[model samples]
Target: MLTYVCFLVIISVSGGNAAIHSLMYTYLATSGIEDVPEFMTVGFLDGVPLVYYDSNIYRVIPRQKWMNMAVESDYWDKETQISIRFQELYKININTAKERFNQTEGVHTYQVMYGCEWDDETNDTNGFHQEGFDGVDLLSLDLKEMRFISLVPEGIPTQNKWNNDSAWLENLRFYFSDLCIGWLKKYLQYGWSSLKKTVSPQVFLLQKDPSSPVTCQATGFYPIGVTITWLKNGQNHHKDVVLGELLPNEDGTFQKSSTLTVAPYELKKNNYSCVVEHQSKTFTEHLTEDEIRAIHENYLPNSTIVGVVAAVLLLVIICCTAYMVYQKKIESESCSDTTRRPKETNPSVLFLGETMLLAF
Candidate 1:
């Protein structure tokens, strides 16, 4: 069992090494030059496997030796070196953008680089070190030469991923980083342009009097980014202003809102402006404190008035009910008086009858 395990371990290591060497070989072959060693130093940098091929030495540098060489200060400047490039296998087409998102998943792409050592360092055995020569691993070079470059498109993972009700937008951003650097840059630009065109900025102002103090709120949005500012007489009023929450949209865009409290007299008498900037242009709306106050005050809460009217109507009904009961009592007493006078009315009738008989 132990032997079998050992055999499996050997196979795995060999396979990994072979894979690294193969990548190195491919990179060297593409250069069409012969100064590099036949062997390769291979490892992973930021997840992507790197294979560095040397032409002078025909054998790949031992893994242990390569690791040591990468850390050694003496070999840092002397190691075999070549131009490194990232290979991007998958790309997302920008034109295929869905009008509405089902998900906000961003793309993450792998950037693979295979470098070769092509300098005329003859005694270096390319990457293969002789038993006596100082060893070097070309793969673990300095952090400067070997690094990860993120090719995430700017707008592909747009503000849509960050807004309310934007689960789809959020999910899609993860996959957008999978593009190559060139494509990502271009796509980011396009996304920014689209965002600038569709975003709208609004300014809100609350005034204390017709022309005294005005509190202002400004918000701006765009595909790339958004900013809010309060301007009093052409100067930014950052100290007296209150900023609200900066909100993000579903398309990787942003929404920003803020309030600036200032003297309405100054704002109304001077040039007061709220400017919203997008990618292509700036949208501006200007008004005085008095004008803004008129708009805000004009909106009356009618529900309160309605409630008061309903209460008065109920009170009137109760008063009318009580008065009707009082009048009913008065009518009942008058009827009683008429019943008591019945005897006097009978005597008058008798007298009238006697007079009629005499005339006959």
Candidate 2:
């Protein structure tokens, strides 16, 4: 999962207040032999993608006929180059993850995340980089270790080559920090001028399976700092709650979901609601007993209809088979009766033979 945070900050720089852009980008990739495909995402500011990605690759959009195809073609070429580099790095990280997990086969996962936060106004910047294999954080920048820490299958390797070269590490940090700052500056200068539009979420309560938790989804919202929570008895319940990552919508908006597990008795007895906060506006949607009942009631009729159709089809098949068997039995009996009957001679032939014999 790729996650990042970006915000506009008013900070004092050179004895004057300026609108500073704080931005971060987290690049994450996970791969497994089964159950999970190779996936990569580059996230900026609450999981928004500067480039759209899915299905193990980027989603390329076609340019209009009136647009300049040459320039658009170059743009796509650059994106493809970047995607190739990311895939190469992903392979390296996933291989290392496989070794660390001692997994030669079956399902396994690996992830690499690189994040940097920069404030151009204050000239303050921080760098974050980490690698995870099989849900374990293996390599990261450790202040106490004074270098990158690597957790291997054999043991933890605290001493790295970078430990002896602090200047090198600082140079690396500056390089990435400058890159983000420059990108953010360019975005502010040319990409967007007005504030992002605010949109209210369309909330839904979904239960895919009876044994699974109930999901509360909020879609088609913008300006990404939205919070979605499940409340019980007018209070937030975090114990059985799972908060999902924010996702970008097709229209440059945002979407998120949260799930909660509650017993039927508790849900009926206590008041439950999905509370959403976005752009200083709060929206609350309560879950009622009637709504729950309606969901089950709606599902039951469809299931009953399917069952009834199947039963009718089975009965028809059985009746048809029984009729065929009875017809075959009747045919066998008719053939047996024809074969068992005695043959009779012609009466005229017998009378003629008797008259000839009396005359002789």
Candidate 3:
């Protein structure tokens, strides 16, 4: 159940103007867990899942159809081999982590999130790398400083050692600066036809009750970038409106909602409407007292604003969970085998560590 929520993923919409494309990978390894694999890895491109690997399957499987069609069987054959190698390394990682923390038992995890972003309009590229133990960041790579930094005192030793290793640092430099970016571009090129696809949004006006706020909902949209605004009698309105986060549908589309608080008396007198803007489309949902009667179809009665947000989050969040699919038992042991020697290391996979390095 270890979770890390530090990375603020700047997702992009494919058909939007000036989209920042990204490629990110998350690796999780566990110890002292049942019904969960010893290691798992998931890769994302522009917020869509691309590849998934786990100890249970001992294979690197594409999560999206485009990915499978774009890549060859030999590519998967090579990736499976690499993933199998990494699984052994991750087992050693878990064992080593327990020793560093001085914990003999209980479930613990090592997680890493590393990736790069490319701005299509500007051709600018950025890299990100970070790792933690048991859900807390222990070491994160700082490309600007060319160093590993530890926010907590306990991680200082490992940070200093990693920074001092020139060969390892140089490999990381190449890994992020060139290799990661190269891979991202290749994937984008391979999947351009599929990645550039877009689906228009469908808008709805909903009210939970006469006393509750009226909500404007936009669902079944692709690319994920959109805006919901309130218009009062043809003029832009901004008062007492709450916007929801972009949510993913099971079919790869997106959804969002915005709530407007207006008195029943005003609803009858004033013309209030919701405007949703997405790629090449503008959807306007006009609010009416008649729409209030439709509450039974789509509404959650929650007084507190926090509860409303939480309720919205709870509705589809669990179904969209990317993790929690692992299958196996884990050992309460030491850390991983030396990371494959940096030289001749494959660029397809790069796994950072909390307290250990593969070895230069």
Which candidate order results from sorting by lDDT in descending order? 3, 2, 1
Candidate 3 lDDT, 146-221, residue by residue in tens: 7877755667777787787665565566566666666677888876765677888877777767778888878777
Q: Rank by TM-score, descending?
A: 3, 2, 1
**Model 2 over residues 1-360: C-alpha lDDT tens digits?**
211211111011100122334333323344543433354433333223344333343532321221122123455454444445555555665665566557757655444444444565567755554555554555566533435666544225322543455543443343344444444444434323222345676666766555457777777665656788878899887878898755545444556788888877777789999898876478887877666545544442221122221222222222222111000000111122333321222111111121111100
Candidate 2 worst ten-residue window by lDDT:
324-333
Between prediction 2 and prediction 3, the one with superior lDDT is 3
| CA-lDDT, candidates in order | 0.28, 0.44, 0.63
**Count of clashing residue pairs in every prediction:** 45, 0, 10
Candidate 2 regions exceeding 4 Å error are: 1-31, 35-39, 52-75, 142-147, 151-171, 191-195, 205-216, 227-250, 257-274, 288-360
TM-score of each: 0.26, 0.55, 0.66
Residue pairs with backbone atoms closer than 3 Å in model 2 (clashes): none
Best by TM-score: 3
Q: Against the hidden true structure, what lDDT does model 2 obtain?
A: 0.44
lDDT of 1 at 300: 29
Best by lDDT: 3
